[model samples]
Target: MAGTDAAPADSATTGPVDRAAWVALAGCLLGLFMQMLDTTIVNIALPDLTTDLRASTSEQLLVLSVYTLAFACTLLTAATLGGRLGRRRVFVTAILAFTVSSLLCGVSQGPVELIVFRGAQGVSAALMSAQTLALIAALFPKARHGLVFGIYGAVAGLAAMLGPVVGGVLVTSDVLGWGWRTIFFVNFPLGVIACGLAWRRLPQLREQPPPRLDLRGMALSTAGLFFLLYPLAVGREQGWPPRLWVMMGASAVLLVLFVVLERRLLARGGAPLLRMDLFGSRRFTVGLSLSLLFFSVFAAFFFTVSISAQFGLGYSPLRTGLLALPFAVGGVLGSVLSPGVVDRIGSARTLCAGALVLGAGLAWVGLTLQPISGTMSIPAVIAPLVVGGIGTGLFVAPLQTAILSDTSEANIGSASGCVPTVQQIGASIGLAVVSLFFFGQVATQAHSAVPATRAELVADLQNTAVEPLFRAPMADRFADCARNQLTSAHPDRPAPGCDGDPSAQSGMAADLIGKANGQLQEAGRAVAARSFVGAFQTTLWALAAMCAAIAVLTLALGSRPGPNKPE
Candidate 1:
């Protein structure tokens, strides 16, 4: 029952490349651009989203995390569905579906509604993403694969780097007074254009017997991922309860079962959602491992930096988003130059060089950060960010080719689909771990700031007309209040009993009270800034270390496969 109408013989792989092929490729790339853009675009809008929706910390996390969780969970199943139902059919449908979901997300009245629509959007993205590489392969000859994938990689990298910039612009511009909603709404035109192009120009290849749907594999995979990812996403916010630990343990068991099921199904000559035999190649295994490690670090780096820049540095959304512009420029440059480098030193060395440069850039950014007041000098970090971006461009552009070098033509679709799956899973795990680490450090740093806060408060009270007896106690209260404010889950809200009123002398002069409050507020800002800067610096160091490890891992990948010979 899973099939599409047969197409003309020329529509097969041997078909000549023409304007239609290029147009179809553009359609596919547009989908890729939107999908990748959405991953990080929403991040810059989170502050506005939180204010507008009155969303809690957990709800905010869910709005961001669910899209990725849904996308990662559905990729394998969607890829198989594409093979069964017809790639062009499923792809065009998904583009329209994604557009509708984005519209729904833009119009949602509550966090819950937005979350639901985001999940829908992610599934549609998966449906479209799952078909992209396979469709590209079918469209172009093997000899042009590198060139085609380079263009693909550049679009993907550009979209990701530009996400914050685009979001910031839209949210700041507040087009039609939509504020953050414009981020989602902007997808409408792009999706419609892509759908139109794809429907008309995307070739319908000849239908083969459909592969059986791996229903059990899909269920097991989905359940296992949920159990694993859900706990990580919410564990810190919920205080790391025993239930989360139990869920993680259950996740391990479920995933083991999923693997077993996959292998057994493959042995029985059944279609497994993930082909177990892909792991048989050391090259493929190493490539996947590298993806997991690389993406884990990359995702966490962006999340931490964006939060610190906006929250800690008191930057406007536009300023925070513009901070990535240098990186984006660098990424594009690196991507553009990657193929030439690969030709000279091969893919492994190019990747190694890229990783080393990225690590150095991260370290530079960490060192450049200062705990002082006022805006951070963007110029100080521009060079480092650009270096890091270039490194990212260098690594990402060739990663697909390297990963699939050893894979057979028959398994290319399966292997390509798994790449994004691992990347998303890595991103999910990274965000969870970084959140836990960053927030813990924030709390610890806040606690450590108490002594300084108390001293500052005592000095300010010395200039006031208050009695000595009341001064020490008031200073202690102020210090404790500052600590509580910094450590709260919602730091923007006032802490309890922090009204800044002198407890002992309710009848104190109004001028004296105002002065004391002003001093204390200034001190609080200083303490908060220092704590965040310290935490952000440490997080950067950790990520830089991971990048170095990625560089080392690149050496383990097999030599880049030779160029394809003409059949």
Candidate 2:
């Protein structure tokens, strides 16, 4: 909207103090907070949800992933509808629908019911999210764009980072005895308030002589995105089955066909769900690619850190959540400072600086972790987390500004939809790739620990009454059991042949046997912690490399236009 003509009916000349405009922006940010919060909040509550509903592994995956799938698939269509009907109208409707769906999720008694409700919530979230940028552009004048977008970025980033924190607090506190259901139930009041504010303050800014809906384009794009995102979401957990690859291939074909169809429609002077000319601008194209690369690091870094902190370090959910606080604080600081930086240097240089700072922070984090010590000092990592957070704040909002800098009024909605869709897909793909690397490293490290475990096992059995011949065999079995347990998919469950203590089988004295078993458990935990630490360190290095790559990519971005100058 910064580069586009203002709607004739709208008061484009309004300043930041215009109460209606600021209020409307507040409502949009609230909706955005809800949408981003959902992307990760339910994750921390999964263990409770699984037990409550008796969900299987596949069902658990679906419960977590279906929301993203639905949101990604519907974004393009929702954006188009918002432009044709009305941004405010569609946004308010989405808020009401999202509120209802969240309530339904809270009351769901079965896994299937919850999954279905989550999908509905996702669709509503897409409708709300797709209209946010367009609405912001329409409500605020171009002069205030940087400040407004910085605030928007700060809210969006903070919400995402705080999801686990909030989820952990709710699950631990068990307010109203709601347990995991509190996560969904909490959304009810927020949605109601957002809806009321938006409905009252948001003005209708429909496209004049509204374009006809391109039903075929919508269908193709939806199917294409669904096929592409679904496998990326679940394929790793499912072992990258051949069927998933086939789905990805089909997605490519469908998307290519969709593009072809849209081009032809535009040539014939028909309405297209997406405008092809948006990509013709080098800034939009490069900026979109940068968004994808940056987001890939964004979600993957959190996922790896969450697993490492909770499982590897034996941290409670609340502790894990608290660990991210430094990062959030840093992000807020960065967000607050970014607009001023942009004004001084420009968006491209600011993005480069952010990427470099983030990469350096990540590298510091990786170097600080010592797998040999088998322990992580939380205090040591806090500084790097804060630094990384600041970098995130600096990059995210400005990246959005850079991408849409050249988008025309007619294509703003489409551009908005494309940015988020690419980001979500990038996140999904990053998670899949990082999971493979992380788990594979875990397995390798687990197996490598066997010899040391065998040595410790033999030492423990040395003074026992167990026969010498049986001692070697018992040590071998114990080592194998430890490896198997550490590498198992469900590490919480005992691996086969690992349930009974080896000391009990050796017929030692009761006290000695208990002592030996305790030692064995300690050794097993050490192996796991070390394995996870090593894997986490490797992941951090990879993410840092990605950050460096993002910085390099920023070199290709066009410079931001000066005040009152043409882009």
Candidate 3:
């Protein structure tokens, strides 16, 4: 409706959005929302899951990494499969798979179960996401594609913003006594509705005749990506140059073999797994690199902000999610305006501006984080975050245009898959790198701050801690109890008195006071804030460096007016 007049000169032949087309778009949009939602929705619940599952920090990180890795690796194959078969068939199958996976994830009892289900969800997401752009292309005429894409951009940007909030709300609500399980469970109903809508509304475009599945290519690429990504994802947690390094080396070898296999496939006149020639186009190559960089930074934003709001500022998940609303508003504002900017200034200049603006926003955040207090002034955080959000919106859509502008229509699905696969991989890398950097920095800072031994530190913690130890078993055994009834764990279990006599009455009294005083003195408050803020600033600095580098590459991207501009 927004850009109806921009429809192709011949678009009227198919008429307007029409009952079927409109319905189909809505259905697809819902599916898209679900997939994108899973990407960020797990952030707020990570700490909760760590406690409930008795998971180590590294194990918790796996719950996030495996999903992205599976999603990224399968994307290219999924897109090609959709194009060779039918978008409708793939879409429907993916939705069902994703729904069942969500149910499985909700019921998971351990880290393995959760990781496996998350992988399943990622595979389904790959199938679903690849066809979205391709189907949208067929739904509208060429002239109207730009406007449709803008709508798509707005939907994606908005979904990402809402994910953390929705995750936060569900986690905070503890509905049906579900606790963190509610976050994954909420998707069950949403997924079912999406499936039903898609079945009824999506146009079953004449199914294309099936082509060869490129089995060899698929296997090689899948293995190669697994090798490359598995190490990257798990390395930071497992320690680099250890077992991760072995996997990293193996992945490099396999990726090299994959490249050789692709060459052979091309020589044999077969369709390669990835269109290797995509790199031949300067615009495609440059645009893709920038997209990866931009998303890498954007992904970091969600993780950092969520942690800062919850662990540092002591906000609940819902409140933290609410804090991110301005990001979505800014994102929408920037996305809507990007088309016009590209029309007038061209994609290159627009991207350059986005890069510089994003840098400035991150710089503002880095500098101001020092002064951020527990009172949590929404305006202070929102304004600069909004500026960064706007920068994100401005940079993404135009990059897509530049990448696809010269691609053959037949290969558009592959092109679309490339966009998201690169994004997910970049996101995985960003998270791993940032997490390692943060932990490394915190460990370093913590050690440097005091010469106390671990026992001494623990003793100091026992005597002067200020906050409740959420990690202790007593806290966990009673985790099912209501928050109001949640009593201090260690205090309930009496320790030896100062004179070495164990007595419940006097020991309990002294223990309670000590517990309160210790909780009050615990570095949970100061250390959490200092470590998080320090890591956040460092990560931002890294992102700024990445942004500037990508900006340089963006200049090499061919000059294009983008789809929205009149020829």
Indicate which candidate wins on lDDT: 2
> Can you write out model 3's per-residue Cα lDDT over 1-567, one digit (the tens) per residue?
221212223332444656666677777888888888899888778878878888766678779887888898999888878766667778888998998999899899998889899999999999999888766766666656656666776677778888888888888889988888987888788788877777745534322445577788788778878877888776754556666777678778887887787777767767776767777788788877877777777777776777666765567778888877777777777787888887887878778877777777777676666522223356666787788778767876566666666666555666778888887877777776666665555444434222222223344544444244622422222222211111111111112332112243365544644454343224334434554455566667777777787777778875654445632
Clashes of 1: 0
Error of 2 at 187 (Å): 0.9
Cα distance off (Å), candidate 2, residue 133: 0.8
Highest TM-score model number: 2
For model 3, the stretches where C-alpha displacement exceeds 4 angstroms are 1-19, 56-58, 200-209, 312-314, 371-378, 444-523, 562-567
Candidates 1 and 2, the one with greater lDDT: 2
152: Cα error in model 3, Å? 2.3
In the order shown, the candidates' Cα RMSDs to the true structure are: 3.6, 3.3, 7.7
Model 2 lDDT tens row, 1-567: 222223423424544447877877888999999999899888888888999999998999999899999998999999989888888888999999999999999999999999999999999999998889888877776666667777887898888888888888888889989999999988999998898777757756677678899999999999999999998888877878899999999999999999999999988988788889899988899988988888889888888888887777777777777777888888888898888788778889889999988888888898889886567888899999999999998888687788877876778888878877887888787887888778777777776666766786688687666667667776777777777876766444468857756444554534444645665566666766787888888889989999999999998996658454422
- lDDT (0 to 1) per candidate: 0.81, 0.82, 0.69
**Residue-pair clashes per candidate, as listed?**
0, 0, 12
Instruction: Write down the TM-score of every candidate.
Output: 0.91, 0.93, 0.82
Model 1 lDDT per residue over 1-567, tens place: 113233323432444677777888999999999999999999999989988988888889889888888888888888888777777888999999999999999999999999999999989999898888777766676656666777787788789889999999999999999999999999999999998778856655323677788899899888888888888778767888999999899989988998999999999988788888999887778878887887888888888878887767777889889988999999999999998888778888888898888899999998888754323568899999999999999988887767765665456657657888888888888888888788777777776666776787788888877777778876777777777877876454458867565453455544455657677677666776777877788888888898999999999885755453211
Instruction: State the weakest 10-residue window (summed lDDT) of model 2.
Output: 1-10
TM-score order of candidates, top first:
2, 1, 3
lDDT for 284 in candidate 1 is 79
